[model samples]
Target: MLTLYRPGTGWLHRMPAGPKLLLILSVVLVVSLLPAHWSTAAIAALVAIVGYTVSGLGPGLRGIRELGHQMFSLRWIMVITLVSQLIFMGPEPAVANTARVTAAIVLAALLSLTTRVTALLDAIERGLRPLERLGLDAARCALLLTVTISTIPVLGRRAAEVRDAQRARGARNNPQTFVIPFLIVALKHADELGDALTARGVR
Candidate 1:
C-alpha cells in the first residue's frame, strides 16, 4: 500500500493519471534546472500546500505527516548529501542542492498521495510503450516499478515485526538479532511472490 495514498474526490485525485504524471515529470525537470535554492524551497512548500489543500485538511495533513515520517527516515542520506555539498561546493550550493532534492521528494510524495497505484502503473506502462518500439517490455517495466514501490513498505513492516518478535523473546535490541529473521522473511516473501507470478503465467 505504501501508505501514501488518500482516497478523495479532489481535483488532484480526479485528475487523470497520465496528465498528472506528466505534470510531475515537468516539475521535476524544472526543479532540477533551477539554480536558486530559495526558489526550490518555495516551490516545495507550495506543492506541499497544494497537496494538503486538495486532501481536504484532515486527510491532507495525515498524508503530509506520513510523507514527513518517510522523509525523516532518510535523515542519514540527507545529512550526507548536505555535508558533501557543503565541503565541495560551499553553503549556498549545498542549501540549493538540498532544497531541490527536498522539493523533488515532496513532489513525488504528493503524486503518490493523490494517485492510485493501479492508475500510476497504467500511466507508467503507457509512457513506456513508446520505448517498446526499441524492444523494451513496457508492461514488465511497469510491473517491476510497481513491485519495487510497494515492496518498500512491506520490507519496512517486516523488519519491525521481526524486531518486535525478538524483543518478545527477550533478545537484545541489535542488528544481529534482527537481520537474520528479516532476511528469512524477505526470502520467503520473494519465493511466494515468484510462485504467484508463475501461476499467473508472468515471465
Candidate 2:
C-alpha cells in the first residue's frame, strides 16, 4: 500500500534513494534466503530500531504501527503457513520461515517510510533500465508499480466501507457474509479507476 513520505531531515530522509532501496533488497534477501536463527530476530529488532530512529519518535511510531497493521492483515496466512510447516518440517523450520518473512516485511516497510514516492519510483526505474535492452519499458514498469501500490490502499478502504455497511445492516462479520459484497465493491472501484486512467490517456 502507498503511504506518504513524512517530511523530515533525518539521516534516512537525506540518504540516496537508490542505495536505500538496494540495501532494503539486500537485507530482505539475506533474511529470507538464509537459515533462520535467534540472530534473525535480532536483525529484525535492529532494523526496527533504525526505522524508529530515522523516522524520529512521533512519526516513527506511527509508521511502524502502519507497517505492523499490514503484517497483521496477513495473520491467517501466517497461521496456515506455520501450521503446515510444523506438521511437515517441525517447529524449528516453522519458526524460521515465519520470522524471516516478518523481518523482510518490516525492512520493506522501513524503506517505504523513509523514502519519497517519486524517489522510490525513480530508483525502481533506474534498476529496471537494464531490462530496456530486452524491450521492456522501464517507465511503464514504474508507472504500473506506482498504480499498483496506490490502488492497494484504495481497495482496502473500499473493503472497509463495505464491511461497515454490512455490519450496520446487522450482517454477521464473517467472510461468508462479507466476501461477495466486498468483491462487488472492489470490481466497481477497479472500473472507476480504469475509466479515470483512460480519460487521462494513460495506457
Candidate 3:
C-alpha cells in the first residue's frame, strides 16, 4: 500500500507532487545507506527532527501531533526492525536500520499527508505514458500504483486499530486473529473503493 494523505494549507500542501516525490526519494536513499555509526545515528536523528519539526504542514503543534499519530500506528514494524537487526547484526546496525525505516515511513507519510492521491496518480501516469507503446495501459497501471499507495497508510491504521481493539477485549492477538480480520476489513475497503472508482468513471 502507498499513502494516507491529509489535507493541509502549508507550503508542503502547495508543492507539486513530482518534486515532492523526488525529494522524498532522495531522503530515503540518503538515510537507507547511512553508516551504522554513532555520528550517522545522530545525523539521522537530526534529519528526522528537522523534517517533522520544521515542515510547515499543519498549524504548529497539531502538525507534529499528526506525524506522531502515524508513527504510533507503525510501532510494530519499528520494533520488529530493531529486534531483528539486533539479533542478526548489532546495536549500531539496529539503530541505523530502524532510523532508515522511521525516516522513510515518516517522510513518505508526510508526502501523502500533503499531496492529493489524484495528483500523485496523474504525475505517475504522465511519467509512464511513454511506455504505452509496449502495450501498457498507462491509466490502469497508474491506478493500480495509486491504489497501492493510497491503501498503505489506511491499512496500517486499520491494523493498529484492530490490534488495539483485540487487546482491549483480552483476546489472543496472534497472527491468525490479526490477519483474518485485517484481510476481511481490507477486502471490504477494496470493494468500497472499487465502487467509488466505478462511479467516477475511472477505468
Candidate 4:
C-alpha cells in the first residue's frame, strides 16, 4: 500500500493534527462561500500555492516536491471534475468549482502527508469524547475519519493500476473498460480492509 504520510521535520509535520484539520475545514468553508467568479478561483488557487510554499519553506523545497507528487496522483479526478463542471455549469463556474476542489485536495493531502494516521485518529477521538455519552463510538468515529482521509491516495493508485493493466492487455481506453475494473479493485480492497480491521477488533 502507498502511504501518504511523509516523514519530515517541517513545522507542518510538527504541528498537532487537531489544529491542522481545523485549518483545513476553515479554508474549505471560506472557499465555498466565495462568489463563483474568476476572482474566487484565483484566491483559491493562491491558497493552495501558499500551502505548498509553507510546506517547503525552512525545510527546503523537498517537502513541496514530495507533496506535489501526492497531489498529482489525484489529477484524473480533478480533470473529471473540471470537465463535468464545465458541461453542467459553463466555464466561469467550472473554473471556480475546480479551484475550490483543488484547494480542498491540497489541504487533505497536506494533512495525510504530515500527520500519522494514528495521531489523526487520536485527535478525532479526543475531540469526539465529549459526545461519547450520547452513544457515539469515539474509536469507530476516529477510525472512519482516518480511513476516509487515507483512502484518497489508495483509491487513486488503484484506478491508475487498473487502467494500466487494461492498457497492457490491449483493452480500449473507454469509460466502461476502466470504470468497471476500478470499482472491482476498490471493492476488493474494501473487503480486505474490513477483514484486517475486524481482526484487530476495530469493529
Candidate with maximal TM-score: 4
Which scores higher on TM-score, 1 or 3? 3
Q: Against the correct fold, how does model 4 do in TM-score?
A: 0.84
Pairwise lDDT winner, candidates 1 and 3 = 3
Per-residue lDDT of model 2, residues 1-203, tens digit only? 33535676666778898897787678778778766565665666566555554554244376566556545544544666778878998877777777676666556656665677778879889989999999999987986775654555445446667767987999886877777887888788778867866875777
Q: Which segments of candidate 1 are over 4 A away from where they belong?
A: 1-3, 36-39, 54-73, 147-203
TM-score of each: 0.65, 0.65, 0.79, 0.84
Best by lDDT: 4
- Where is model 3 poorest over a 10-residue stretch in terms of lDDT? 1-10
* Candidate RMSDs in order: 4.7, 4.2, 3.3, 2.7
After the best TM-score superposition of candidate 2, give how far the Cα of residue 119 lies from its true spot, in angstroms. 2.6
**Candidate with better lDDT, 3 vs 4:** 4
Residue 148 C-alpha lDDT in model 4? 83
lDDT of 1 by residue, 1-203 (tens): 34457777767788898898788768767777887565666765566555555544244366566556545544444666789999998887787787677666666656776788889889889989999999999988987876655565455556666767887999997766666788999898888878866885788
lDDT of 2 at 166: 83
lDDT of 4 by residue, 87-200 (tens): 999999999988888777766777887888888989999999999999998899888888887787778768778877988999997876777788899899899888878987
* Model 1 per-residue lDDT at 8: 72
Write candidate 3's Cα lDDT for 23-125 as tens digits. 8778878987887876676776677667777667666687678777877887777887899999999998888878777777777777778788889888888
Give candidate 3's TM-score: 0.79
